[model samples]
Target: MIALHALQYSRATRILWLLADLGQPCTRIDYDRTDAFRAPEELSKVHPLGKSPVIEDNGEMIAESATILRYLVAKFDDDSHTPPRGTVDYWRHEALFDYVEASFAEVALRAIMPAFRGKPVPDDAKAALDIHLNYIAHALGDGPLLFGDTVTLADIQISYIIALLERVGLLAEHPTVAAYWAVLQEQPGYISATRTAGPMVPTA
Candidate 1:
């Protein structure tokens, strides 16, 4: 069985959604993230970084949200959560997942960091975020999903960031993102991942 060590309200939620999309059975172990957003010390036992969203499959440990998502897809997706390999859509899936984290999420996070610190988002940061969001909005072009008609991990990956933006009130300014977020909400595990996963308790 897959063992997922999730940090509440973190990217681990993305893994939960990914697992659901893949139709995989896994145990979701939620952890209390500190007010500082750090995972509890116990997570260090699973991965040296002590990060949230670590996973173990058959004794092999995996950390990092995107890595865990891709690993699950490689091992268990079986054409369920993603398109078949070697197709345009499949390659698009790979690029979008990586881009969602490496590019788009980076900007979304910059915006989120200020909110997390209880500070006003600076105009410059907002501008930078706008540039990135516009890029994604354009990349989405005419979309329900990033590629093809069906939902895929790519959508799930990007949608997680979009949800973050929504929570922070940034999503309303972007029409494409709003539309995509609407479509993404209907997918399985979306509510659980984005809203229903709930908050972490203090790990005392």
Candidate 2:
């Protein structure tokens, strides 16, 4: 069994979704950012940052949401359905995944996050975010998924970020983003993770 350290409304949801996709049984310790449950000091035993989304498997600990997702996919490759790593689609997926992850981080910090938290974002930051959004929109190009037809790790990771942006109403006027978000929300693992997270709130 895997042990997952999770926090509500964090990237930890991505790890949970990946676990569900792999059909693995895991234990979760849910933490909240509120005063009552500060991140346990003991968590450094699991990760350097003492943060959520740390996973323990076979006496080994791993942190970082993207790393966890890749680990689960590689560890359970036989049983889990995943795209072939050697294929062209896989390369495309990887490219898009990196682009979106990097872009979203910038946009989140600059535009989406501030708006979601009811804080004001600078006009310059919003403009930068719009440029990134346009890039994502172009990359999408009417495809059901990021790379092509099949769902890849890229889809799972990027969709979660998109969902976060959606919660903040950042995609209100982006039809392509809305379409992508709709398809992702229909996935069982995505739905499970989202339900577990409860209502979305803006937090790091």
Candidate 3:
């Protein structure tokens, strides 16, 4: 069985959600955050970066959210969670999947860092975040998911950042994206993952 090192308020839920959607069973090893809201040192024993969502499968350890997602889909999924390998939609899926953490989440986290430190978010940071949000709004258009009605790994990858934005009420300004998130929240896999591992935002 796969062993998942799940950290509280981390991207591990994305993995859990994917596993749920794939009907895969695994062992979940839980970790709590430090008082500073960082992953505990215990997590370092699992991975050098001490980041959450690390998985052990076939005696191989995997790190990074996008890498793990791709690994799981490639190994366990039967193309239900991804598009055909050589299609235009497949390229779009891969692009958005990578963009989630690299572009969107990076700016979203940057904008929220000051608030986490008990300080005000600077105007420049807020501007950057707004730009990203607008891009998402445009991408979303009038849809339920990032790429039509079917839920793909890209949508799963986007959920963590969506939860973060929702937690801070950033979605209030982006109604389309907010509506999209509402739809995602109702996904059975998301519900199961939340019940098993808790919400995606930190509590400490």
Candidate 4:
């Protein structure tokens, strides 16, 4: 069994969804953000970074959304959500999984920071977001998921950034991207996670 340390409105929700999708059981410890919208100091006791989605399994601790996702898939996925290893599609899966945080999520966070601060998004930030959105749209061309109609771990990895874009209204103009998120929200695992973790975006 995995012990999940989850935080509100954080990438932890995606971890929970992944576990639910895999039908894996976990002992979840939920955390709430402070009035400043930061993780409470209590979380530091669980991990040095105090970030959510940290997992304690078999006496080993794991953190970072992408790292945790990879660990979970490799351990519990039973190949249901990942392609067979060493195939072209498998490499694509690995690349897209890393790309979400390294590229798209970074740009999405830049664009979202201004909105979260109650300021207008800068032209450059919007432009950068548009470039990434176009890339993602092309990557997902005419498919419900990144690879095809079936959802994969890469889609789960990318969900946080998509939720952020939707929260800041960046997805309004990109119908394809917007629709992709809609489909993700309809997943049963997503529904189960949100019922406990709330929405991907924080109300505050």
Candidate 5:
């Protein structure tokens, strides 16, 4: 069994979503930003950094949400359930996943983090956010999803990142992104994770 250290409104939501998508059963240890993730005695049992989204599988611990996703897909997914490898589509999928994970960091720093604190966004950060949004708009190009028409892991990952941006007022200018977000929200796994994660906090 896999044990997931989860937090509300954190990247742990992605892990939960992936598990739901794969129909895999796992245990969740919920934590909050204000709390110490692991008890003092259990500290060594979890990640050294005590971050959420750590997974313990067969006595091997894995941290980082993307790493967990890749591990789950590789270990538990059969051909019909896994993304294709060594192809154009596969590379495109990889690119989108990279973009979402990297781009959301900038978005969070620029928009969501400030909103969570109930503070005004810095002008410089807002400008940077505009550039980020434009990049996503260009990448999207009126597509139903991030990587063409299929609902790949790229779509799943990017959708949650964009949804977090939306909660921070960064999504209003990107109509294509908004449309893609709506479609992704309809996915069963996404819906399940959203319910568990709840709406994004206005601040970090």
Candidate 6:
């Protein structure tokens, strides 16, 4: 069985969402953050970085949301969540999965976090966010998901980031992103994870 060290209002929500969508049963171990919004010391015992979304499976532990998602899809997903290996869509899946973190996720995190903490968002930071926002909107295009109606790992990763943008009031400017956010919000798995992750994350 997979065990998730889930942190409320953190990236772990998406990991839970992914698990729910994939129909995989997992033991979710919840953690509370310090008033300062830092992980508790118990988390550090799970991994060196002490981050949420760590998964323990088959006597091995994995950290990082992207890494865990990749591992799960490769090891546990069926054709519904991922295409067969060696096809174009499969490679696209690989690219988008990595791109979510390597590109937008990193930039977006630095952008709205100060605002999330009630600090003013800097002009340069907003500018950087705008660039990625445009890129994300274009990627989302007309469809609600990454590959039309298909819900792949790319959709899971990007949709969670889109949800973050919504929470922080960043989605209004990007209509395409806003539409995609609306679509993901209706998903059963997303709804389940949202409710489960609610108490741990910020209401803001």
Q: Can you list the residue pairs that collide in candidate 2?
A: none
What TM-score would candidate 6 get against the native? 0.90
Of the two candidates 1 and 3, the one with more favorable TM-score, higher being better, is 3
Regions of model 6 farther than 4 Å from truth? 199-201
Mind giving the per-residue lDDT tens digits that candidate 4 earns over 5-51?
A: 98888999889888988888899998888988899999999988887
Off by over 4 Å in 4: none
Instruction: Spell out the clash pairs found in candidate 6.
Output: 9-201
Angstrom error at residue 40, model 3: 0.6
Clashes of 4: 0
TM-scores, all candidates, are 0.86, 0.85, 0.94, 0.95, 0.83, 0.90
Worst 10 residues of 6 by lDDT: 195-204
Better of 1 and 5 by lDDT: 1
Arranged by lDDT, best first = 4, 3, 6, 1, 2, 5
Residue-by-residue lDDT tens digits, candidate 2, 88-188: 75676677767655656766567875775589877988778777777788877777866566566777777667876777777887888888888877778
RMSD of each: 3.4, 3.0, 1.5, 1.3, 3.4, 1.9
Top lDDT hit: 4
Candidate 1, residue 34: lDDT: 73
How far residue 78's Cα lies from its native spot in candidate 4, in Å, is 1.6
| Candidate lDDT values, in order | 0.75, 0.72, 0.85, 0.87, 0.71, 0.79
lDDT per residue, candidate 5, 1-204, as tens digits? 898877656777787878888888788886655453233334345777656678989999898777788888889854432347787767866877777777657665667677645699888888887787777777766577665565666665666567777776777877777787788778788788767666433233
Off by over 4 Å in 3: none
Better candidate number, 4 or 5, judged by TM-score: 4
lDDT tens digits by residue: candidate 1, 5-60: 88776777778777665666688787786767677888888778888788888889
- Candidates sorted by TM-score, best first: 4, 3, 6, 1, 2, 5
lDDT of 3: 0.85
